[model samples]
Target: MTSLSPAPLISLTWTDHVTGTEGYLVVDRLVRGVSSGGLRMREGCSLAEVAGLARGMSMKEALHFDADNPGARYIPLGGAKGGIDCDPRAPGAYGVLVRFLRAMRPYVEHVWTTGEDLGLSQDLVDRAATEAGLVSTVQAAYPLLDDETGARRRLAEAFAVTVDGIGLDELVGGCGVAESALAAMDRAGVPHGGARVSLQGFGTMGGATARFLSRAGLTVVAVADVEGTIGNPAGLDVEALLAARDAHGTVDRGALRHGDRELPADAWLAADAEVLVPAAVSYAVNTVNQAAIKARWVVEAANMPVLPEAESLLAGRGVTVLPDVVVNSGTNAWWWWTLFGDIGPDAEEAFAHTRRSMRALTDRVLERAAADGCTPRTAAHALVADRLPVMAERFGWYR
Candidate 1:
């Protein structure tokens, strides 16, 4: 029996308040010659928390690549994550971020490729380039980010204000959330064509999810942004709302109509819907509001949207909460499919492959979870954990 625990290859910590922050760079595994993950900055972030996130990235990449295949021509990259405990909006935050990045350049240059996570944006990337003189390397690394393009471009454009020549491509990440949500709905015997769905958080993840799910014919009855939650029980115009969402995914209150009601924070959770998507941040479904959650399924579009303890309670209540490790892996799968897979001249064809691969991956994970009688999160982790020995043997990690 294989136990699912985060066995990180290395966990490095630094406490340099002189640089105005401290963080951890946890490299969970190395598949071939490389590893990849995100870099986030938020107050109270810890080494252990980043280590856990790195493990999730490891599971995400392994499952997306069909690690169990053993002989597949996978990308051979592992999972790594870095983050600092600080506010990104503070007066000296930019200086602190640049100093931190300069200090970590040796580790990030090759061993661990990182991207934006949580509070840190492309501004950090842009400014870090000017301050640390690593714009060329960052330019190459950022385009590899398949999902969340809008956010990245915004960050790169933030570079235009003070710097020159750095560019970013457009990307988004919620297709996997929609696909996995529908896959889970399919397994749970729910009708997606007319399923009532509500999303909390209207950022790139939630916005893209609303777009895809709505296009698939699901009724998005409610959506919440930073300002507040707004809904129309019949359905909300997802595309219009997506276009209307601001830089930070704040939807305009004035744009909502058709008997729309501005509900309280808990309204999205309690919406009379079949699915609830928490695409904002971790611990969205905690003990206090977990009880009010009426949806039959909870799809985590954001990383760790549902905490472990709250998840147990939801399971007891019969709410099937799909884990981010499986549900929100569209971003990783897109990276594997686009930047990594064999490409032809057709852009649409490549995108089609991405969609098919994502759907298949989600379906397989859901199928395994059902068969194993474990949560999808646990099942996905098991799938990755089981392949570690083979990955080591193939990639020569231990040698």
Candidate 2:
């Protein structure tokens, strides 16, 4: 059974009255009357982009389903996504966000549960949601919880968790990404000790990924932020750079050491590294820039960071592109895992669950790719194809 339909279940567009900015919400699928995804704010976000992201969310949700494991409590929701076409750093951006939330509040209260994505943060989203008079971003899912109060408390407690000054919510996704990369290395027989990585975008996902991978013995040779690219052939200090980042993930240039060399922004595409992570904007690695990449693996830490044509080109050159639907799904899954009682509100438990789940999924995707002689993304789609039918049969598609 195919997981994708010709079009989304529902799509809405809103225009902010004050700033004339545009916002979009695409509900690609619905299970038990609700869907899950993130709300991203950026200058050029469009309906088409949000639709693609929503569809990806659906696949991501289905890929994590272990229907055989009856003990699992975290049932994957349907996929959805929200996007706003306005720069988050622009003047009156906050006001625009509040208005967008207000306009999208009905969907939030009834069908779609959202959090930070791309150019926004959870704190910012939560604050704006409150200003929009909403109960919570995930209020739509309250009906699915057996103990709503306890679930809310558990989620709140989990969000309060901090390991070495970083929030657990922020670290879980990165943990998943790092584990996936490690799984790929294991499949290829590459030692982690001297494996090099270059990352684009040092925000929540990128910064957290750098931390986990660096701690796991991978040398982060270059990291790109809004300012530019910072490189150190001998490997940069991951912790120091992470500490110097802003909420939007831009690193403070003042924190660079003498040995650190500044390179052009897109130079990260060509860094001498074993792994390249595009954790920033969509279509970051397009056909033109894909030629510059020399990494063995392109680990997608962001949604649709590598264009399809670029991925095909990379594949022709023998580069493996780990699909984002599987690679960067930890953060979304972690929220449900904690809220639905599949896992507790502790850092170790969260990390353990994310690692096990992501590694297994990665291995399965890689193995499927090998067996079918297809790309990892196609293998992931094949996996989703098997599970989405079961979810629909059990939950009644639109529920």
Candidate 3:
């Protein structure tokens, strides 16, 4: 194990509002590194959750370094997350959001750069950035779209043209939880074509995932946003849904009615499908709704979408649950590696490289899990744990 320095300490502070509610800003494991993870915001976000995500970023950086030719040394990159506690669904929340951003401007500028996440839109991010007088570059001018088609087009073409020597055909599996789910399905002998799918979120990751699966011949039957859940067993119009979705990740209610059923807030989980993607928020599949899940396979598109008890329950019911860490790590990895601008030709190439790396990593984890008779989650964690100590040692943190 490579050991160098101790993991840096992180701190968080909560500020109370006049309504007796509180919001938090958390810093986790800063390496005095060149870049820091983007800030994510959502309701009911906790310090522990932010810390966990930050730690994941650290591990991701370490793993990327390990994979470098001749073994790249660790660079000083850090992780941080912040969020407000109020419901973004409420009226005049924009003003509240502005206030929150302004309040944290000083600290944010000093240590972190905020980015879009659940309950936060790119438009919102730009507004916040503008208000804080932060520089707005790197495709920040575009309107928010759930599908992220532009981003994906860049990512796909780049991977096919730049990274994979065999060209686009060899760029079969990309990355993220979506790739992990695909890997699992391949392992279980489940065919991809005509498979029913229902997605709970329609954000950048969720929308891109839906498109990827659809292109691969899966039938996306339902998609849910914060506005409402829309289902059509005959297959949803992914393009139409994308067109109707607003900046807040909510779809317009006035859109086409095609024997569509409007389900309750959590009804997306109950949609009959071969695969269910919980891509919206954390703990969406908690104890309260564990039994309601009917999908044969649940792929976590969001961080910690499934609770421990819920996961165990799903396992007992013969439902496979793919872990979020390795799945979501694709985008996270791309973002981090691109910090140096030396990763590839453009952002798209960087993202494609990230996908390839993630696919290979997921495949190895799945193979090891099957060979060792353990869960994919267990095997992935074991792989990371085994490597982290070595990385720490190589950096002289351990003696």
Please report the candidate that would top TM-score against the real structure.
2
Q: Write the per-residue lDDT of candidate 1 for residues 254-325, one digit (tens) a residue.
A: 777768888886689889999999987676788778998889989888777787999999988888888888
Q: Which candidate, 1 or 2, has the higher TM-score?
A: 2
Model 3 clashes, total count: 21
Model 3 Cα shift for residue 182 (angstroms)? 2.0
Candidates by TM-score, descending order? 2, 1, 3
Best by lDDT: 2
lDDT of 3 by residue, 89-179 (tens): 6675566666666666665555554465667665576687677565531222112223345443543444445232222221222335566
List runs of model 3 lying over 4 Å from the truth: 1-8, 16-21, 32-35, 59-65, 71-78, 89-114, 133-175, 342-351, 394-399
Worst window of 10 by summed lDDT in candidate 1? 162-171
How far residue 234's Cα lies from its native spot in candidate 1, in Å, is: 1.7
CA lDDT, every model vs. true structure: 0.70, 0.94, 0.62
Judge candidate 3 against the unseen true structure and give its global Cα lDDT, from 0 to 1: 0.62
**Which residue runs of candidate 1 sit more than 4 Å off their true CA positions?**
1-7, 15-19, 67-74, 122-127, 135-172, 344-347
TM values, all candidates: 0.84, 0.99, 0.78
Clash pairs (backbone) in predicted model 2? none
Clash total of candidate 2? 0
Model 1 global lDDT (CA atoms, 0 to 1) = 0.70
- Residue 165 CA displacement from its true place in model 2, Å: 0.9
